[model samples]
Target: MDEAAGSPAVSRRIAPQRASLRPWLLLMPLLVFLAAFFLVPLAQVAMMSVTEPEFGFGHYASIATDGFYLRVLADTFATALLVATCCLVLGFPLAYAMAAASPNMAAAMMIVVTMSFWTSFLVRTYAWMVLLGRSGPIAALLDWIGLPHGELLFTRFSSTIAMTHILLPYMVVSLYAVLRKIEPSLLRSAASLGASPTSVLRHVVLPLAAPGVVNGLTLVFVLCLGFYVTPILLGSPREQMVAGVIGQQIEEFLNFGEASALAVVLLASTLIVLGLYHRRFGLDKLWG
Candidate 1:
């Protein structure tokens, strides 16, 4: 029998000083795990980015000078911004509807959103492939309607639409959380004070939902920055994003050093976004 267990009441009354150490003690294993797996691997990648194929920052220099790499990096950010904007535009109304619905209606909407989200990511991408392909239903419908079905597959438009669909639930849930927390009386009071519905939403609701907007944008943008399969499969070969370029370097050219460097750049960009958010609003508040 352990002494701590034998004298349960005595253990519960342990000195206050030791209680402070308990949290750290409980966290030790997770710290060790992250240090071993995450920190060690990151360090290795950083070392390889500079040291592989002879040292001396050649990969970094090339990235700075090369037009192709610079263009891809720019395109990556542009696409992420587009995707995040589309998500917010489409999600805000749906989330508002969900919040405004009765309990049963809201519950059903949530279930549908959750089911879509839980469906395999690849499955969603492939479904988009089927829908956007030349012989698919969308093109068929266009043709039937006497409209010219110009090329749709392997276009930026297709990729953006698919990515938006895949990420929409994230924005919806973020907005739904914030919207649900808003007091109904506040909106009623605004109306009673002779404010129009649009005015009430613009002044009161939008102000309250700002945190969720920031959170959804940050979440979607960061996720879009790292998007791999969707862009490669759906986007044009001429327009490549950072993740696709990184994969091409590793798989097609076997340029590990350059790929590692690109990966580091992407990681740094993500960290900068997070840092800006933290500076604006504490990280703890973002999740809430």
Candidate 2:
């Protein structure tokens, strides 16, 4: 009996280690890919940021000392925040509706959202440009409505609208995944306990959905921060974002140092936000 008990305990001890090893084994390929593609590239960029154009911290110093660069950084963060907030506000209702939908309806919605992902992003941006440009259909409609002719294209407003549309699906899908997992009985229980519809939502639904909301917000915010093509196509010079600035430095000025420095700053900012989120809300909760 003693030998049998000891054998069980020994197996228990070995079981967890063996199980852990399996996951690490499964993760080995992903780790190798990340190290090869992401870490190596990132290391190269960091080296270029500090060591190019005669070395030292000149590129970073320019970012700090130049008022125009500082303004662009601020604008980039502002635009990202605005786009995230808009996505949240717009996506929440759609997510709720999707979650409450029947299986067939939800499947249909998923198909539509997935189809959007297959569409070319550049084509979508150009479509927006064609619709919003002066003398385009929207501009013509405004003129016919007795409104003043508006130059909406190539403006910050146009950029924001386009980005919000592009990112809305991400937010919806994130929230939908979490919302679908919630037990319908929980809401029914709240109602049975004399909770009103608004009370049930305010107390039960919102708390349950908090994790998904945070996940979606983080996703949208990070994506918006790194936006390049849409902003370049839709925004004017004054509305240039960090990504646009980085691209110009790399492509037009051939200043890889400054471009990499800007990229590092953007990367650091994103990491800080993610770290704070993980600290405050435990990363495990984000996966539904």
lDDT of 2 by residue, 211-271 (tens): 8899999888988999999999998779799999999999999999999999999999888
lDDT of 2: 0.90
lDDT of residue 147 for candidate 1: 94
lDDT of 1 at 190: 97
The C-alpha lDDT values of all candidates are: 0.92, 0.90
Output the number of the TM-score-best candidate.
Answer: 1
Q: What pairs collide in candidate 1?
A: none
TM-score computed on alpha carbons, candidate 1: 0.91
